[model samples]
Target: MSHEEIIKTTQHWLEQAVIGLNLCPFAKAVFVKNQIRFVVSDAKHLDGFLDDLDRELVFLAQAPADEVDTTLLIHPTLFPDFEIFNDVQALADDIVAEHELEGILQVASFHPDFQFADTEPNDIGNYTNRAPFPILHLLREDSIAKAVEAFPNPDVIFERNIETLQKLGIAGWMALGLQASQK
Candidate 1:
């Protein structure tokens, strides 16, 4: 897909799955403020994708928080396998630590095939983290801290998300029309 198409699709997924379903209670605020940056990386290889990742991490770290609070680094063609994507996620963490951004920045991962351990692949709950493509969601630590502080019972977000998704079910998820094509 073209860059514009990729972005539009990702945004649609955000609107339909994340914000529409209230999976991330904190997403709507930044999204409505236009503080989320959607970056589509054209890299076809892992090393090249890491270069994109490094650039985005630096970009997010240096940009003013009010202007760019978070980033969804969308790579359409790389790491199609969820296991490989999970492994690459570790490299992303290492990059943050290497750049001394452990506290300043953190990475959250999402993929079309996101699955929690022991959960069935088609479980509705997995859709909580499912996006149209493999995404590295870069978030500011301070922002997360403040949001968590203001939100009550932050620990229950996961359980709540599972319950919400269970109510939605696989049929409901399919109704959103954002599921990535199965490989």
Candidate 2:
């Protein structure tokens, strides 16, 4: 699917969360454009960010796609830290192992130390100053199974996530953990 399609598809998924989260229309658009994976730090403000998608989020669609390499470059912003990402990645690996995936589902997240000033690697995706965190670009999927395998158990991850949002309020939620930020 094209980038627009991906954004739209992701929005559909977010819609389900809106019932409880009450996300604003614009925030929904921004989150999808930025490719912020499903997460809510402050259930209240989760919609706020959705209402105003940062310009950085919009560029995610324009990112170049890889033809031969199927690496999924995940920006660090997606998770709280490397440990969380590693757990998620391990979960993905488990899914792949269980499903017997073909092709590759390589992963990459944000490296706080990696600077844009450094020489660009041909294989790595570009980083945006606006969305300074990290991002995940699923390079390729031989089948739907491979693509589906990339995600972790949302119920498990978001269970505490929702509570955190409720307790922390919008500002608090944003500051607390790896809540989804569209920008």
lDDT of each: 0.90, 0.33
Candidate 1 lDDT tens digits, 24-85 = 88999999999999999988799999999999999999999999999999998887899999
**Tens-digit lDDT string for candidate 2 (1-23):** 44454344334434443322432
Q: Every model's Cα RMSD, please?
A: 1.2, 18.1
* Clashing residue pair totals per candidate (backbone < 3 A): 0, 16
* Cα-based lDDT at residue 9, candidate 2: 35
**Best model per lDDT:** 1
Best by TM-score: 1
